[model samples]
Target: MRRPAFHTRLRAHASACGGSSLIEVMLAVALVAVSALGLIAAQVWTAREARAMSLRESATWIADSIAEATRTPSVGNAALNQWSAWASVLLPHGDASVGESGAVAAARVTWASVRDRPTAGDGIGPSAEPCGGVDAPAGSSCVALAFAQ
Candidate 1:
């Protein structure tokens, strides 16, 4: 057979190497899949964080509302009486605008705090304040507690 030209040999080599080799294609696909999985996990984590943040913020608001409610003699008409002892109480209170569930969660800042002042009327209760309206901030519920010395 006649000797093959250098150009022909190079062409043959290129064809053999052209397109993605099986290993290269597999690696590329795996890399893409891994990146996609990572992105999805990040998104999931962010979503969970957002939910937790909302819950946390709401909890703080509940605490503030308790304090505000306690300052008055008739806060929630005797809902905040339990502030003297560190106790947490959750009730179906607040605006339904957050959801039809129309539920509100109230908890003593802490069991220790609950006993701070024995003098109490009640703890913050549900529907103590209007929430979930344009006038009210989002994800915040205000409640009134009836507390006194």
Candidate 2:
């Protein structure tokens, strides 16, 4: 019997392999989609962290300002209130307070932070006071500075 021509054999092989290319393409597309989703999640997390950091930096600056004002005898409660007002304007539900414990004075800045989600068993929530024992609201973050009297 005469053997089939090369073109015929190639055609037979191509027909046999028909659906495999489609499957491979589908798998590749799925992989790319999953990777893209992961990248997008990372970007979102990064943006949230950047915003949280910016808020923390602002809190720190406010705390430092409080400390400076405390050191200066001329600076009064009005100045401190102004700083608190500034914090409120700059951060979400922000507040600042100055407290004295014995010889050490503390400046506490508190704000509601998007990143302050309550984790499991951490016991951190609205009532949890993390900033030098100051009463921070729910889902809030704080920055505290202690300076000598």
Measured by TM-score, the strongest candidate is 2
Per-candidate total of colliding backbone pairs: 26, 1
Question: What are the per-residue Cα lDDT tens digits for candidate 1 across 65-98?
Answer: 5556544546643544443321233322222111
Predicted candidate 2 versus true structure: per-residue lDDT over 4-62, tens digit per residue: 69978899999999799999999999999999999999999999899989999999999
Can you give the TM-score per candidate against the true fold?
Answer: 0.47, 0.86
lDDT of 1: 0.45
Alpha-carbon lDDT, every model? 0.45, 0.85
Worst 10 residues of 2 by lDDT: 118-127
TM-score: model 2 vs. ground truth: 0.86
